[model samples]
Target: MSYLIKPAGYQALLDLQQTEMGIKRIKDFFQQNLSSELKLRRVTAPLFVLKGMGINDDLNGVERAVNFPIKDMQDASAEIVHSLAKWKRLTLADYYINEGYGIYTDMNAIRADEELGNLHSLYVDQWDWERVMTPKDRNVEFLKKVVNRIYSAMVRTEYLVYEAFPVITPVLPEEITFLHAEELLQRYPGLTAKEREDSAAKEFGAVFIIGIGCKLSSGEPHDGRAPDYDDWITETENGYRGLNGDLIVWNPVLQRSVELSSMGIRVDREALLEQLRISGQESRQELYFHKRLLAGELPQSIGGGIGQSRLCMFYLRKGHIGEIQAAIWPQEMRLEAEKNGMPLI
Candidate 1:
């Protein structure tokens, strides 16, 4: 029921200058820590992609993408990406990346219709990563292992951030709890998914609400995630929840795993076909990426996105998202935040 609960003790700690410095330090530290932990390589990612390639994340199956006309190319619109979910997978396959190694890229996107709030933003930024996987490592256990590694990287990043910005102390909950969507539903049949997450997170301090895509007993997915990357059944849940009922969910949480590199035993030709049929996206086979996937040309990989802004915000312990990033804010919202003593950075 609480979409936005304004925080008390309103004070913006970092000025624009300190905020900038803190942002850079946080980013630099996270990059170093994550790359080292996951054995990931930093690569360049595109700001836009060719539409209809099925490479773009259709967030919630509805949000509009910022578009521009490609000069001298008739009728070809270059869409600013919402996120590079499918692209990274294809990149691993096309680039012939080896197993046990993956790529991380700075991904920036424009979401035209994002609801302006303390957290939501029109401009998106994250570390999108993907890597090759073998047929053997696609299961709940592997997913849990990967999640733990990612959390460790986060904790390490927090430590590094505190080193530079001693004033910012983020007491990240030590252990991350994992729970299935069904289990959450069973626990709180009356609560909505977000409400369940809030309750569970409040109790557990951190949680990864897993098993997206499949309908619950309520006949709806606890959240929506695209069909292609994660094998819904095998992938367990992951995410952090803060003490004040804040969910660790960020970036395109359910819609696109922040690091969208889910390379579980690449669905064999048969399983792939079955999934395609079930998702009603067999038509995707016509796309370049889908074709390669069907033909077994791509490598098996598991990857995900790590929200840069979310990480920065988490480290800074800022209440609203605007405190950490320089992005557009409406006058009314700015005024309201200003009244609360939280200035826009």
Candidate 2:
């Protein structure tokens, strides 16, 4: 069964028509701003890729992906992309995307195993981006520099929405705070992972939690990260072990922390092999993409996905994600959202 969240006395700030307009504006303005800030080019992305090539993101590594047989190719199966995490890196090499430049695309996918809720949906849409980089740019400082630029774009988009609608005031802070996962654990020793994020996001207004996949002093990872794409195993100057993290903010409507993006410096040859063995996914080395990386054929880069619906929902101040995008929902969840006055598109 799917889950439901009914925020107390929640109301959408924009009407259906206004919400649609705001979504378009956010999508257009943010992509343009992102491209300018990051020196990226827009590229067309794929809906599905041939199976068994290890090109798709595993997210937390256990969610099932939707796959079907291709009739024209004698029933060869293809899997809908989870995200273009690895594909973007390969593209950077193929297109000869110069150093310090990147690419972005409209990424859509089916997260069939997603537990439907106010935020989670079976239909996933996001902006997948990647850029070529040098080994010197693989540290924490460089990662934060990129994140701040993205956060700045988000703040700009928030103001743009307010310009169109007076009622939706800009709520994003001028600057976002950063903390490592270990630091957060030290502050809130008793809370679960989500609870810790909620506390930090609520207090800071906007935050970026670092070292996400590394095993902390508590002998557990603050959260799970797929082993292949993000370089979550490397030690940093601060002794933290991740070059990736999520940008989170407190959503007034839902009264919960909302994750806007998850990105990191892509893993290099050494980091990739180490992470694979640690996750017990060493068999991936034989895959086409893995072989290329292991053989040093792919370029070094940083990449990530920014959720389209999530961003729209945040800027539009919608109580539920359904107010932003159309996607499959369980009957029970639909009834609950309607009763709570959240009309699903």
Candidate 3:
């Protein structure tokens, strides 16, 4: 079953026109800032890739992609991409993008299996970006540096929002705190994974949790990750077991932590084989995309998706993601939001 949160005493901060203008302002400023900060070029991306090619991301290794048969093409099936995680890496090789430069796209997707909630939606929109890197750059320190650059872009965008919408004050910290998932589990041994995130974000205002997807001392993984893309199995220099993580911030309005992004270094030959073996999906290595990676045909890169509506919700101080994006909501959900004075767009 799906879940929803209705913040008490919630009220729309901006009218329809004002909200539209605010979204535009935020998108414009942040897109420019992010591209410049990461040295990325805007590119067109595919909404769907041919099925059975292993070109699409299998998010969490469970959610099913929306698929259909195309008649004109011999009834070949096409799967709507869950995210551009794998596709972006292939694009890097196809375009021969030099090291240190990358591509970013406005990735739109439909998560048919998604659970409706305060932030969850069937429709997903994000800035899916990837940058080429050398094997030497696949370390915790380099990942932290890239994360800081992204955080700086967000900070500048927050200041811009404050200048325009004085009512929405800037709340993001000057710097985001970085902590490993194991460290977090140790600090809050009694709390669940989500609870730990809330506690850390509340304390630091913003935080980046490193070493996700791998099992900690508790014997269960902090979170599940697909075995193909993110090198979550690799041991880091800091003695952690993951090379990727998520950046989250405490949303004062929602009184909960909202994850802004998840990224990591792409799995190299060694990492991929091991992760596949551990996940018990070694047969995937024979797939086309996997074969290319195994043959060293793709570039070693770092990539992730940053939600567009989530960012807008943070800057606009909206209580629910539906307020920032137009998507079909359950009748009861809509009525409850409306009754609580939380306008859904």
Q: What is the TM-score of candidate 1?
A: 0.87
**Candidate 1 worst ten-residue window by lDDT:** 238-247
Candidate 2 lands at a TM-score of: 0.99
Question: Candidate 2, which segments miss by more than 4 Å at Cα?
Answer: none
- What are the C-alpha RMSDs, in order, of all predicted structures? 5.4, 0.8, 0.8
Kindly state the number of residue pairs that clash in model 1. 16
What tens-digit string does per-residue lDDT give for candidate 1 at 1-345? 112335666566667787788889888877888888888888889999988877787655667788888888886888899888778888887687888988899999888888777667777788888778777775666666777787787778778877877876656577677777778899977988877876776666556665665566787777665566555533323332110111253322122112212222234455556656767778877887777777888777677677788777666766667777778888777777878766876
CA error at residue 244 for candidate 2, angstroms: 0.4
Q: For model 1, how big is the CA root-mean-square deviation?
A: 5.4
Candidate 3 lDDT over residue span 1-345, tens digit each: 677787877777788788899999998889898899889999999999999989899988889999999999999999999999999999999999999999999999999999987899999999999999988898999898999999999999999989998988899999999999999999988999999999999999999998888889999888889999998888877688988999999998899999989999889999999999999999999998899999999999999999999999998999888889999898899988888777677
When summed lDDT is taken over every stretch of 10 residues in candidate 3, the lowest stretch is 1-10
Model 1 segments more than 4 A misplaced: 1-5, 233-276
TM-score of each prediction = 0.87, 0.99, 0.99
Residues 1-345, candidate 2: write the lDDT tens digits: 577878898877888889989999999999999999999999999999999998988889998889999999999999998888998988998999999999999999999888888888889999999999898998999999999999999999999999999899888999999999999999998999899999999999999999878899999998999998999899999888999999999998889999999999989999999999999999999999999999998999998999999999999888888888988777777788988989897
lDDT of each: 0.68, 0.92, 0.92
Rank by lDDT, highest first.
Answer: 3, 2, 1
